[model samples]
Structures are given as structure tokens and as C-alpha cells.
Target: MAQGIRVLHVLGNTQLGGAESRVMDLYRHMDRERVRFDFLVHTEKEGHFDKEIKELGGQIFCVPRFRLYNFFSYRKAVKNFFEGHREFQAVQGHITSTASIYLPIAKKAGIPVTIAHARSAGVDKGIKGKMTRWMRRNLSKKADYLFTCSELAGISVFGEKAVREGKTIFIPNAIDCRLFAYNEKKRMELRRKLGIEDKYVIGHVGRFHYAKNHEYLLHIFAELCKKEKLNEDLKNKKSFVLLLLGEGSGMEGARALAEELGIADRVYFLGNRDNIYDYYQAMDYFVYPSRYEGLPGTMVEAQASGLKCVMSDTICREVAVTELVHTMDIRADAALWADYIRETADYQRKSHVEEMQKAGFDVNGQAERMMAFYENGNFDA
Candidate 1:
């Protein structure tokens, strides 16, 4: 048997965030004999990714989290990199935080290859944006390759510089279709258990943060409930329920908004669930109203789960791999989303099963791609 390529993945933390989850997904399925994986995480608190990484026969090296402008942390990372340089053939940084801070260190360590992967749109506009752009311009040059989940994310960070330089590659986020496939029996069972078996459930699975626009989702649901109560025909024909799965700092505010709008009873807050795919199965329709995203894994998971999705325009187009998904504007307008929810509820969309199969987003395919990148510097551009 041929020897496996060794890869060291450096990430901000092991938290159950998008980038962390993507790395886990890749690690879990990569061919054991083709690519061996390890992780360098920056966090004082051990996170959910730790166990999964260990289970996959990978090692985790924890480093102090680097605050912006913290030269000391950079020096520490540099020291750590030199101490552990011999174990891996290449180092891959998964998001901007790691890429901006560690790419230079990895380059200096003389790793065979250093990859900086862009996983989101640039930082918010203003001072932070300016600083981030400057960092990317200077720090990114050290990376042998730049990988982005979408072209939009690449342009948002690197702008014309990436196109002119010709180093950025777009690799859309892939999900395990088998894990998220349509399971009618499971859907029915889960819906019955949630006591929303008869209601039209509109689902949103994500951390409750500003980017997710949960406040707007509450207002949208409120508007739909009011409309259902006022219009006798619509009321008699349809009733709606909301399933919010995930937790974050914004949870209390979102809960308060639901109460203020008097729709608390209609919304279910299932916080920080491990089996998120089951919640997707229980829903009638999926909605992602994020303000901005590189590519939402929930959106891809929803499509794989065979739920028709209604998302915001700011979400990366890479997640909309099939026609079953729909996009909305990001103005946080309640009435507009309510209208869309109603229209989407009425439309009979095709199941995404075949589409997901055709797309080849299953874990095996995704792992193969990452293995190729690690072993031969081959990535689908």
C-alpha cells in the first residue's frame, strides 16, 4: 500500500461552528491510507471537535487564542510550529482567523505546502474591514494556495488581487447525502414527537447571532400567524409552526422578540442539538435568513434532507446546489418573508434526493477531494 499523506489542519477553535464542522466532516471521511489528519486549535477551552478529531486518529495541539494585534500570540504560534514541524507534510488553515494569523508561521516553518482557506465574506465594513483587508493582502502571499468556499468569499477578502494573482480556488462545501437523506418515516416520527405533526413547520438551524437574522425570522413568523388568524380561508387551510435549532448569545434576545410579537407558543427553540439532521427531517420547509455567509452547512444539509429551502440573498450561492432551494432579500422585512413562506408552502417542489446524489456531496467524495489536495496538491479549481 502507498504511504498516506500527512496533513495538519490549523483552526481557530474546536467549537461547533461552520468551519470547525467542515473540517470534522472532511476528517471523518478521508481515506485512512491516503491522508492522515491532525489539528492545531487555538482555544483555552476544549471544544466539541476534540473528541471527533481524536476518534479519527488525529492529534490536537492547543495554543492560546490570538487577539487582533497580539504580537505575543503570533510569536507563540511561531514557536509552536517550529517545535512540531516534522509530523506533517503540509499545514492547512481553515478560516480567516487561522489564515491571517498562522499562514506566515506555517510558511516560515518550510512546510511543503501552506493552504489558507477562506470560509466567509470579509469582516464587517469600517475599521475592522480595512484591517482585515490589509492583513489578507500581506499575510496571504505566504500561502502556497488559497481555497475559498465560494468566489464571493474570495473576492470579498482578496478582491481583484486574487483574480490578478490567480491563486484562489473555489471549493463549495459538501455534505453527506446519506446522513441527511429524506426519511419519510423518521420525518413523521419526529414531527409527531415534537407535537407539530399537523402544522406546517418552517425550520431554521443555526447559532442565534446577528448574521443569522433570528430577529427578522421572529417578525416573519409573527406576520404569518397574524395573517393566518385574520384571513379565514388561509386560517382554515394552513397553520404554521417554527423550529429553531441551535444556541448562541442572541438566543435570549430572539426569545424576547418572539414573546413581544406574541408568537412564542408557535415557535420551538431546540438549542444546541447534536442530531440536527433529525430536526431538518421534522420540518415541512427550511428557511435560512442569514445576513451574510460564505456557504451555510445548514443550507446544504437542508437540501440533502430533501426540505425545500428559503434563504437570504447574502448566503453564498454555492449552497443552493439544486432548484429546490429559494433565496430572499436581506432587508429583514417581515412581510416579504411571510409572503415567501406562504408561497413556498403552496408550491409543490421536487424532492432534492436525486439532485443531491447527482451533486456527489456525500462524505466519501468530499474526503477524496481533500485527500487529493493533501497528497498531490490537486484541488478542483
Candidate 2:
């Protein structure tokens, strides 16, 4: 083993989602002296983080697009693995497909350490979810280490037979606090720029998807609007507005739903922007009504930004480190979620801000931990 370790991180895409964001965060802050990082992405299409990764001095390898079961893809990926094998001390695969496809090759390449990282509970309903679980159970054991973002996610894949007695390790997503620190000036500026004034902003940041449950969020917001209209106390004290960030396949559907609800005027769909943190500053409350998660990075970022969060209980428990966050059942009625939103919208929360900073969910600490893990090969088994 050498004094400095070289690690190759393999992911299915380079998009600015939770998994990709975390990978970039780690790369940006990891100890340069102790660990060197590079990437392998399956897509040839450029992603939002590509330029940033290159600027950080990490190499990017592009693999051809192929179905996970495609033999040609495996052959090409294996060849690529051999080409970079000598340069990397270890290889870490970030998603199920990547893990299933590359772990065997890395093992054969005689890499000192091969890690299979499970970043989500598995994809939502479809043949895709079934195939991902099958791969996790059948192929994940090839790696020297199995890592998951949360205990729930690990169990969902490995089941009681494999991980209940402690076979896999849990490392919740880490956040860079400095990046989301409370910027009073920036918050005001963003609010002015967005033309959001004299209103309470409820924010949700994620790609539109079934798992994210954006339909439920719209329903909840509509309920809140109606409640405010009827309740004198609520009507006089505060106004409600929704801020939706990110774009995806379900985006147009989501926009249509908002229009159907007749609250389209009150909702702002900012699409995708590079300065998401700025939007966080302008938000008054954060809502994450996800049906499932591997530990959401947005939850951490929202809490770090000092916004009181109302998330689905299932996902909120994974991020139970903060008191500023509240949760309800994923199947909770719209009325219940609406009540929660109205109650917390006007509440002042300075104590929660202090708590997040104390917890070290901040970026620098997370980077140090990752750097140490790469340098020493210690996974706390």
C-alpha cells in the first residue's frame, strides 16, 4: 500500500441528483494528500457537474451506453477497467447497475479494495426495481465492502438474511454546511430577484418522479390555500407560496397538475438552475414528501440552511439528527400535511440553526471522514 490512495468512483450518470451531488461534494473536499479521486460515468451526454469535476483535477472516463445485462457493455466496461486498474488503488461503484457490472471486473483486476455502494432503497415500482434487487443479492457479495447510505436502504436490498446481523455498513449522506450556511444578505437578495415578497415560501427540490410524490405536494399546497381562505386567523397573518426546483420527465405533468388545482399563479417552477443554494436562502420552509429515499441530500441541505422541514416520516427518520425537522406518514391525508405546513410556516427557528452547525453535518468534516476512509482503508468493521 502506498502513502496516498487513488480511488476510482463509478456511477451510472453524472447528473446533479443526490448521489452525483454527494460524489462531487466528496471530491471537492476530500484530502488531496491522502486520497486522489477520479470518475467513470456510463453516459456520453454532458452533465451539470462535468466541468466542476474536471476543475477539481479528477479524471473522467466515459463508458458506452448499454443495458445492464448486455454482454457487449460488460466486455467494454471490463476492458476499460483493465486500462485504469494500474492507476487506482481501489474502485467504488455508486449504484446497483454499476456495482453489478464493474465489481467482478475490479475483483479480477486485483484491485486492493472494491466497494459496492447502495445509494437508494432501490428504484420505485417497475421491472427495474426487481432487477436492481436481484443484482444486489446476486452480485454485491463480489466486493470487499458493501456500503449503504442508510440502514433502511441496506435492509431493503440485502434483506434480513444478509444484513440484519450487521453485514453491511451505513454511512448517511454528508453535507457541506459552509455551502448552505445562513446568508441573511444572500437570502434577501434572492428573494428580491425572484420577486417573492410578503409571502411564505414552501420549497421542494428534486427531480419530478413517482418516488418524490410531487402530486401529493401539490395536493397538500392546494389544501393549505383553501384552509387559509376559510380561516380568518390564517388568512390575515401569512400568505403561502410554493417554490419547485429541478426538472425531469414528470415535470410537465406536475405543471399541469398545478394548473388543474388553479394555483399555478402562486407556484414558481424555476426548472433547473446552477445556484440552487441561493433558492434555499429565499425559502421559508422545506417540504420533502418522498415515498422512499437512501437519505436525501436536500433534507440535509434544507436543515443546514435553517429552514424548518416537513418530510415523509419514512425518509425523515434517516435524517433524525436535527430537531428542526418534522415528518408525517407518506400516506398521510392532505389535510394533515396542510395543517403542518400552515402551523410551521410562520414559526421562527433560530435554535435549530445552531443545532445543525453543532452536528458537523457541515462539508469540511464530511470530506475529512471520506479522505480518512480512502487513505487508511478503514471502514469501521
RMSD to native for every prediction? 2.5, 2.4
Summarize candidate 1's per-residue lDDT along 276-341 as a digit string, tens digits: 777788887888887788878788788877787889888777678887788888785678888777
Root-mean-square deviation of Cα positions for candidate 2 versus the true structure, in angstroms: 2.4
Which portions of model 1 miss their true places by more than 4 Å? 124-130, 230-236, 347-350, 379-381
Q: Estimate each model's TM-score.
A: 0.91, 0.92
Q: Which runs of model 2 end up more than 4 angstroms from their true locations?
A: 231-236, 351-354, 357-360, 379-381
Top lDDT prediction, candidate number: 2
After the best TM-score superposition of candidate 1, give how far the Cα of residue 298 lies from its true spot, in angstroms: 1.5
Error of 2 at 245 (Å): 1.1
Q: Poorest 10 consecutive residues of model 2 by lDDT?
A: 348-357
- Per-residue lDDT over 246-329 for candidate 2, one digit per residue giving the tens place of the 0 to 100 score: 878999999999999999998999987878888898898898889898888898888878788889877737676677788798
